[model samples]
Target: MSYKWLKFFIMWLPVIVVGLWEYVRHVFLLPFISMELGNFLAPALVFLITLTLTRGLFAKLEQMQEALQRERLSKASFQQREQLARELHDGISQSLFLLSVKLDRLEHTELNDEARETTEQIRKTVKHVYEDVRQSIANLQSPAVVVDDSWLNAIHSAASDLLQNSGVHVQLDWQLPEGVLTNKQMVELQAIIREALMNVRKYAQATEVQVICHQLDDDGNFDCEIRDNGVGAESSEIEAKDRYGIRMMKDRAEQMDWSFYITSAKGEGTRIRIMSGGDKNE
Candidate 1:
């Protein structure tokens, strides 16, 4: 039998036994005692015991429900990480490899100054793509841990890493409430933030960027914003044709049932935000 059913049977057994004892005392034992107090005391004892057992059963059920939820979330996270790994390997990694080969061939040919500079740019772009591909693979392989630190730390770390490596400056002003996030949510949030930072590095070309993360008053609702001050929309339209980072970020947010918004104006900047109704207690 399932543990829930077994626990129910165990908890109910005491009530059943107590009820029988009370009935016997009132119907038979009370006559021997010849006291109305025995009848009252017997039923009172039964009631107390039954109440305790019922509370225990309810507590056990609550614990079981929490455990099941955590298990389901863990399984889902593992599956998603696996799928991301496969997609990165099959799609981005393969494309980067082909691009590298093309760049190598171009380098071997003789070219004018302009063509040579163009080849160099292509090589740099290919190198950046390769690095991103490697990082995505690494993130997929890394195990997620729940820590008692600020969520902003994770966001800052990702942003800093991207900026330091890609020569982009990210300005962040975020205030988060004192609450923990689940492991799955953290992983999802981390991936989403990383993707946004990558887009800034790859396409934004803005000198400065800003990030914000905060909780809303409603239960389970939270929001994050990432904005950059760079050569914006017009350049972005020309750049978006080859950029998959934004699309991947949106896809990851959608997978977690979150809302994503992005806006940009030419010569102005780009801004991206994600909103979700996700539990914040890890």
Candidate 2:
């Protein structure tokens, strides 16, 4: 409101200057108002006009700057929420499913020393749940961590929860130099990796898994491959529930204009490849 008044006053500046000039010329006689003093006052009046005009302009610019900052903060908050949702789906959700499977086995399976073994399995599964909760709390405290070797630390952080909770083994190998992929790209890529690993833990009765990340120099593209030695499915046949994760991985990869593909066989293991444009400066 005060700034608006400032603008309103400035709007009449041209008329004010003319009125003041007429008053000075007529009311103050030639002898009283010296020519030298009049010349000095002219420049002073021009300076005051410039100052008033700039005041309103500066106020408008300040308001625009503040609004832009607010918009950036809101966008950042939204991105963080999306990332958190993916984490829960990939980490804690899988752990719960595993717990349910364990309980199902305990309820149905029969053995000589069933009670003791069943109790142990249930305890271990419950312990995994506790550990995942603690890890989730820690993640809430610290959103991300980086290793000395650039993205390596980020990849480790991404996989830590899944490895701790799931029975399957994961092995990571990468040859990515620093500044090959931007932080945002790295995060989305890591989320896709976690999703693939989660599916393996939940569905693939695998014993060992391998993750490889490499960049293709010819086209400045990154290639990530995840392979597991588990009961795989036909690439052509996908169940409705399993397809959601696949679609999500593809969607995230597409955010960076990357490519996502999957390969599997009934007896052979499953492999996922996510190729991204490897320009870190973006």
Against the reference, the lDDT scores of all candidates come to 0.74, 0.70
Best prediction by TM-score: 1
Off by over 4 Å in 2: 1-79, 82-151, 236-242, 277-282
Best model per lDDT: 1
Clashes per candidate (backbone, < 3 Å): 1, 0
lDDT, model 1, position 36: 74
Q: Write the per-residue lDDT of candidate 2 for residues 78-175, one digit (tens) a residue.
A: 56755786677678767777776776687666655868686778777677665455444444444332222534665576567557776566789887
User: Candidate 1 — which residues are off by over 4 angstroms?
Assistant: 1-34, 53-57, 79-95, 98-106, 109-125, 145-153, 166-188, 205-208, 235-239, 252-259, 276-282
- RMSD in order of candidates: 7.0, 11.2
65: Cα error in model 1, Å: 4.6
Could you tell me the lDDT of residue 137 within candidate 1?
Answer: 90
Instruction: Summing lDDT over every window of 10 consecutive residues in candidate 1, give the lowest-scoring window.
Output: 142-151
Tell me model 2's lDDT, rounded to 2 decimals.
0.70
